[model samples]
Target chain A: MTDYSPLLLSLKVAGISTFFVFIFGVFFAHLFSRKKFFGKSIIESLFMLPLVLPPTVVGFGLLILFGKNGFIGSWLLNWFDFQVVFTWIGAVIASIVVSFPLMYQSAAAAFESLDARMENAARTMGASNWRVFWTISFRLAWPGLLAGLVLSFARGLGEFGATLMLAGYIPGKTDTIPMAIYFAVESGQMEKATFWVVIIVALGFSTIMWLNWWSRRNIERYKNDNA
Target chain B: MLEVQIKKKLPHFLVDINLTVEDEILVLVGPSGSGKTTILNAIAGLDHPDDGRITLNGNIFFCDNEKPLPTQQRNIGYLFQDYALFPHMTVEKNIAYGVKKMNAIEAEKRIERLVNTLGINHLLSKYPHQISGGEKQRVALARALATEPSLLLLDEPLSALDSRTRLECQEELQRLHATWKTPFIIVTHDMQEAEKLGDKIIFLESGLITKTVDNRSGKMIC
Candidate 1:
């Protein structure tokens, strides 16, 4: 009997991580896109570190931060009796850390592309800053933001090294699709590994196709609207 | 009365001007980069002047020493060169955006009146992207007028329209101005448009007002 728990768990981790990633990504993008301050580049570089660092390095860093005896982990354990290490929650964290840069970069690009005049027009018409952001800025940049969301979700789904170091490989509890595939190939179960690989490839392809379709539809709609 | 005395240092030159206007169309006629739009932006509080004061009807809109009221509270209507309509919103929503302080029924009534006056009633449910250039201009004008501001600033209002559409919009603007009874400052490079619409035309050259022509008698005042 083939267990499909790994695939389900991987989807769950990716979905939850993407939610947090989307919020932070858009918020930081909105913040950084409009202002220039001291240490702006430094702050931006720190958020982008995970994308450049090797997966093993990122995983090891997370392990040190969230281990039971570690700073945050120890506080949580003592006060709330809640543990994150070697659990599915740890997997979600790892996924978020690994995938956040993709979301942030794309969102920032989208925000930067917006016309400053449009926002200024809203303000001159007596719309507050908050209302202008929601009504004008976010609405215009939705296409690029949605694309970033999909990319981050894909990145989270494929997370391997961070998940291994933080969540570990516990079947039906923490083992994700990538981890299952790794263990299957290591034990010479090529057929089992192949099955998971096929599933992942199919999912990735469908996402790309969907993204292309969405972009094409938007272009056609724009043409029709303007015509 | 609107009183403006401001000095802004641009990269190319210094923009220093002092002017007063009443309920008349005051046109800033100049070439591109002559600081015409800059004056409009400064009045709307979209751009800050290095040091100056702007007062409208005894209310101080901006004073360099004091914290200027933000753009949202300035109660100025600004029509951008491209109209700058919110592309995602319907024509009605865009017109009603600034009237958030009004009750829903009052807002709806205002929107209905403006839409009918602007002849955009049929386009109320359509997004900006779905409208033609003339329709977009009408919608933008309605949006700017919906809030009942004391002052109106327009930057190159007819520059984006084709010849035929521009003539129609120009007539529409003149008709609206007759009833609105607010001080208007319009920036334009087209001399004909300036002569036709302006009661007092300020000719700017190199960021300074070289001449002020009173078009009321079809003669140059300077």
Candidate 2:
């Protein structure tokens, strides 16, 4: 009987995936909202597709696209020596894919709530695009983006069917807490599984509470701003 | 030195503009929807004109027939009607934002001078949301001046204030203008404001310049 490595591995995977989601989410959201481009609405819909689709479907799609013999999978394996199937990294990719819509929408809406004049003012002050994004756009949208980050991270935590499909049931390698709980229930280890479930419940509850508190404080600050 | 000629169309208005302002205050007075702000947006590089050129100090800020220089290089400062300060930053960071070339020490000195002169020193650490509207105006002015802009564009600078505060701001604007010596382009629809503060007035109606007045002369009445 292998120990609890899968649980820890899942946490690691979820954390990494959330980081990438937040970084790229904010960037692309800013791009989508601020700068108009070709096929903008289509790009937006594509980003949002995972949000409405079944997690299993998304996992299956990711599998067909990134599995070793698949189109992008073979290219990456040849060029970057990266194989994305049945790994902890695979679990993260699935989580990020599912949760990115939440992040992007929140961040984009936050960016939009801001006055465009601030960016214009920054430009006239000789601040470059990088400067305006960091000093003006990013700073102004901080609270909204933070709320998005927390939502995505929590979304990653609850991920089950997607993680099970994409990362598989490799004990101590890719079996995450959700998959472990499922296996425990199926195999009649109800008591042990309940202990792990409690831990996750506590973590989820506390994380959500903190997120709520942080967002409330941020909202207050924003209100004070518009006051 | 600045020269501008531009034609741009919006949903309900067609903005065709030509203007020049030297080292002096140029007040723009117009009815609502007359394209006064559009002209300011054109000059600020926030809005692109459909055609023509904008030049400043012998350099092209924007020329439709040629490559365009970015707004940051234009050396102008704009005050928003609502004082669109970055809500998160304290008064100091807001001012420091535009003062990129100023060394930290020089920036500090200038920030102090601004706060002292504008009478907002006590509110330096306060957020924009925490300050009174009048204080916010001074803070905005300080932020605009922090960059040492070649020209200052004040968009209804005192319009958001109460009557008493508006008068105070009008006086403060004149005082700051005298000290800074940079060109000021004040935009407002209030004819009284134009009469009080403008050295020269450009009256815009429907995005077109209709009348130009020498406000400093005793010959003009609102």
On TM-score, the leading prediction is 1
lDDT minimum window of 10 residues, candidate 1 chain B: B99-108
Q: What is the TM-score of each candidate against the true structure?
A: 0.95, 0.94
Best by lDDT: 1
lDDT (Cα, tens digit) per residue for candidate 1, span B52-90: 999899888899789987899888999998888877778
Candidate 1 error regions (>4 Å): A223-227, B218-222
lDDT, candidate 2, at A20: 98
| Docking verdict class for candidate 2 | high
Among all windows of ten consecutive residues in candidate 2 chain B, which has the lowest summed lDDT? B213-222
RMSD of 2: 2.2
Residue B158 alpha-carbon offset, candidate 2, angstroms: 0.8
Give the Cα lDDT of each candidate: 0.90, 0.86
Fnat across every predicted model, in order: 0.83, 0.92
What lDDT is obtained when candidate 2 is compared to the true structure?
A: 0.86
- In order, how many clashes per candidate? 0, 1
